[model samples]
Target: MPSLINDQLPPVRHYEAAPLTKEQLDYVDLPTIDISSFTASADPNVRSQLVAQVRSAIAKYGFFYVLNHGLSTAQTVRMFDIADVPFSDVDDDEKKKYQSRLKETGTQQGYKPRQYHHIDNGIRDQIEIYSLNHDVNKSGHPAALRPLLPEIEQFAYHNHVNVLYPILRLVELHKWEDMSESSGHTDIGSLTLLYSQPIAALQIRTKDGSWKWVKHIENAIVVNAGDAIEFLSGGLYSATIHRVVQPPADQRAYTRLGLFYFVLATEDVKLKPLNSPILQRRADIWLKERFQGAEVPTMAEWRKGRTKSDGNAELKASATNLGVEEEYLNGVLIKHYV
Candidate 1:
């Protein structure tokens, strides 16, 4: 119910890193379903059946799309239209302006889009963002900022602030690192996303443990489980793996727009097993999959408890043992399970 704002810049939750490769891209698919079916179901039994289907898709694939999700086509198009702007590319003067924030924040974590991604194609991604999470000092002001590093968002960010603000409240998190890399990861949370339909290149993992491509379906929105869902549901659901791959050597970084709406925990929510009998054994297996001494939090519990510091440094040391890239959210956990 509190607010979060940084002085120099807003709090950033999503991270942008280098894009994934094509060969690596061949591993997953986002699932699709019709949300309208909920309206059509004639009986409670049928509705339960649908919920079960949702649960199964989550456990098996960790990603899926919902048709008739209730978002309007106009809103969907406008969001992407706004996304067509080229914000990721850094000009010479812009880069220097951002450098000042790095000194003021006294943190390596600053506005760093250009430094994070050097490639700039013809039309760069117009989508720019600002973020704030868990800075108790800035909790009420909604403007208390850590210093801006490389780039600061335009004042127009507030135009959509009314619409976007409610979405962040849905988060239950663990430590949220800046997602700037070729490929990174996400904490297990309920992702209620509103995506642009005229776009492409969204892929997710599949039920058979394979990868499949999911193109944007008109008027439909995709929902996927994050690690928290998998942990809390005791393996009845899974935290899906997904990524945005670079178009080609000939391509630029500005792709279409994607707004990820996340719901996470406020404190360190434990993940053991659900009380459901069918899930107990799977939960045990999942627990075994977790590395020892890991800080596992449900989306809701972790977000409220996080303060940006060196806590993740302890995690960095552990991640080396798993043989995966260092930056993805659950790099160690994914490698351990997969």
Candidate 2:
């Protein structure tokens, strides 16, 4: 895998980013499930054990860590190496040429410059993102990234097909409050897989309505259920609200590089709860009413609206919820905490 990367690019290690202090390492206690057996073994007992762990984790926490899902340390480090190239090497003009067309095309498929998202109190976000949709050839990307597409494609496929699919299939299967740098909100997609970064900024809201840091595990992927799954499960699976904040003083100087894969349902699929009795029996009345009408947006309309609306979030009072404001996506009200 190292040979696949350009020799000219220096290696970037996750631990080098920022080491957390003893006190800074306070992380929420969450289950860590080893999934190697489930992905490799055909044995039903092996698979069932894995499923049981996942079912319990999701039911209790809405988030958990997955170990041995097939990615390696060197391979993971190489990704950060690739990530550093766009922001550190490419010029602003060249990068902007491929700037995210989320505003127009409704697809977040290109470079998103720093401070692109608005936060509260006149603060703009400090993160830069270069998102590649499932289709790599759909549009042009930065020239520097061209040489690395093969590597990127392989990595993306590993996540989408190799890892996400099996997890999605089990049992058909079972399926945070924070206001910080990235603010408190739920992900619009079905599932989220975030690779580990040593920075201590990511936090998850607990069942008690308090936030706690998420500890970094070596070579482990942070898996969390999102809004789509919650909807599909009839709200049986909670879409945990989490956010990013500035790292401790020791880590603030280093740039934080995150690798994430968001799983979204297909465009034409109607946004309705599945007919599974296990899902339908949940007591989430709001989830039922939210999609009860024929006017519910298709995945396409909902995704496009959510992606575009997020970038242009206009802060205003919400008549419904306090301590937050409102935005809309295809007539659906999306709230952002202050």
Each candidate structure's TM-score, on Cα atoms with residue i matched to residue i, is: 0.55, 0.87
Q: How accurate is candidate 1 locally (lDDT)?
A: 0.42
- The prediction achieving the highest lDDT against the true structure is 2
On residues 1-338, what C-alpha lDDT tens digit does candidate 1 reach at each position?
11123354323433232343333334244556665555566787766666676666666666666665444655444334333222333344553443323222323222333333211233333223423222312212111132332122221132123222222222233223311110334443444354524334655545444445655567565666665566666656556666554444422453445554444433345555556778775766677666344556543333322212112322232344442333223322332121
* Model 2, C-alpha of 168: deviation from truth (Å): 1.5
- lDDT per residue for candidate 2 within 1-338, as digits (tens), equals 13444567444433345665455455899899887787689999998887788878887988899888776777787787786777777899999798887777677878877787888777888888888865566678888777777777677667766677666752232210110001778887777899988878888888877778999888899998887776666667777788887788877777788888777776555566676676666634655466443366666677777777775767677886667677655556666665
Q: Which stretches of candidate 1 lie over 4 Å from their true place?
A: 1-30, 39-42, 81-128, 132-188, 192-196, 205-211, 248-254, 266-268, 282-285, 291-323, 326-338
Model 1 residue 29 distance off true place after TM-score fit, in angstroms: 6.0
Candidate 2 has a TM-score of 0.87
lDDT on C-alpha atoms for all candidate structures? 0.42, 0.72
